[model samples]
Target: MIDLTKDGDLWTVTLNRPDKANALTEAMLEKLVDIAQDASAARCLVLTGAGRVFSAGADLDAARAGLATSDLWERLSSAIADLPCLTISALNGSLAGGAFGMALACDLRICARHARFFYPVMKLGFLPQPSDPQRLRDLIGPARTKMILMGGEKIDADTALAWGLVDRVVPQDQLRGTVDELSADTLSASPTHATAIKAMI
Candidate 1:
């Protein structure tokens, strides 16, 4: 499930199905796409999850049903990347599989200390969403990207931060507050101003 919360100029989209480790279904992916498309009006948009795992990627049954290789993953991440706003992935816990696209697309990623990052597409016998490899490479470089995508390495939050995959590693208790603090300036800025600065970057 995807839950969207709008607060003034900030919009936060959360993965809400903790029971399944927030494993995504096609419908959930579609909702994320819709929300990202509509979030252009917000000055800041945050992507996060409801529980201990940010997402385990596609639901097992859904993956078996072809959701693992769907174009929707590309569409969703592309929409988020195209948004003319500051986008942050507030990773609550471990991030894996297809879910890597959204985090890779974000302007910044802040994760809890215990969070881990991995993408097992290579091991899973599916190519990653088209843009994911390049986005990930841009952040952490090709060799390190290969370490995860090819070597199937599960990186800890500190390693992710060191590699530039995540911008910050905060205590879980301070996660929301850190996001709020990071969002404050953009939230108060004129949308046009924020968009302009983002474009310049």
Candidate 2:
């Protein structure tokens, strides 16, 4: 589940399954896609998860049910990656498995100091489809991505920031404020200018 709140030109999307550490479900992915579509009119977007984690990744039950290949999840991932607004993933806690894809899809990532990053799909006997390999390489370069994916190691927030996987790392309490300030800064730009600059990148 997810909740969407709007404040002026900013949109905040919160993953709302704290009981399960916000493990992503197929329905949740569908709603995420819908929210991203609606965010087209906003100047900035912020994504965060409820409770202690940004997300633990895919719901194991759903994954076991073969829902990973659902069209909804694919569409949601693509939509988030292509969102026109400046999108930021507020990594307030650990991000694992498919959740890494969600954060990587964002234009920028702001993480809490205590956060950890991992992609355990291979350990789960599954490979990330939909071109996650290239996205990981683009975010952190091939060598680092290979180390993380192949080694199946969990990296702390500092290491992730150093590797360019996260744009900023701050205290847990500062996460939301940091995202708010960054979103304001992003929204200050002309939409055309922002779009053009992003296109060039």
Candidate 3:
């Protein structure tokens, strides 16, 4: 359910299961972890999805089927957080649940104008994993993160940008071009310098 392609020094990873709104499965997360680990050789890495979502988060059916193990979640989160290349989430559509964690793990995010961000675990009588709370606080401050987690409020692209959940918003049609431009800029930097800066942050 994932596709990887290289263009010059940039690596693009696309979530390919549009039929399910790109909801992530255990297998998909495993592949994602592998790709993130391997992307170190690329100057930049872009994460996006096909069709209407960057990802809808975990596949509910798979999760209910006991396919999402705690060990696997930890491995996937660590792999994303420790990625060596400059990583960008090209949020081409709305995201929810565990997908928000993936976006949070990225070094930066460029979201589409129509995209919405939400984490509704509270409604499901569950809490997000530990990394999600910490990452959300680090990205958007504790107060806002608390509101998101506690209140279960969904934020639109503009509000997400204003609240620092996303770095920028682009028109849907411009998402690919915008990501290409940003990745090209990232590729223009010295790999060592870029890696150092990302590590420092």
Candidate 4:
């Protein structure tokens, strides 16, 4: 359900289930953890969706089938968040539910102008993964965190950029070039400095 490509020190991991809007399954999250462990040599790691819809969130079916999808997802997000290299979430399309945590876990988020963002835990009556609220607060502050967690607010790309949920928003066609430029700018630093700053932050 995912594809990994490496060019020099850049590693790109794409969620490949376009037909399912890239909805994350337990298997996908497991693969993510494995790839993340192997990405130590990468200068940067980019996470994105294949066709569109970065991810619709955790696969409900898998959860219903007794898979500990949320636990696995939490582990995957933590693994990515702790990566030594610069990390980016290229939101080529909208992100929702657990996907929001994935994007938030990234050091920087570059989103498509039309890409949307939201978390529906309130609406679904489900408690989020243990660390999600703290992660949300870290990105957008406590008040905004309440707005999303309590109010179930849905934010579009422009609003996401303005609200500190994303670092940049680009039109669909410019999404790739924008991410590439940012990646190149980040990678220009010496590896020592790059990994140091990543850990410092």
Clashes of each: 0, 0, 1, 0
Please tell me which model should have the higher TM-score, number 1 or number 3.
Answer: 1
Q: Rate the local accuracy (lDDT) of all candidates.
A: 0.93, 0.84, 0.84, 0.84
Candidate 4: residue 145 lDDT (0-100): 90
Best by TM-score: 1
TM-score of 1: 0.98
Candidate 2: worst-modelled 10 consecutive residues by lDDT: 68-77
Candidate that scores best on lDDT = 1
TM-score of each: 0.98, 0.94, 0.93, 0.94
As for lDDT, the candidate ahead, 1 or 2, is 1
TM-score of 3: 0.93
In the predicted model 1, the residue pairs found to clash are none
Overall local distance difference test of candidate 4: 0.84
lDDT of 2 by residue, 85-161 (tens): 88899988999887776677889899899999888766788777566778889888998888888888789999998
Candidate 4's residue-wise lDDT over 1-201, tens digit each? 899998888899999999998988878988988988787788999999987689988787975674433577677778888888988999999998877777778889998888978888888777777778998898789999998888988888888888888998888788778878988966788999888877776
lDDT of 3 by residue, 1-201 (tens): 899999988889999999999998888988988888887788888889998788887798887776443456666667777887877899999988877777788888999999998888788666687688999998889999988888988899999999999998999889889887777766888988888887787
lDDT of predicted model 2: 0.84
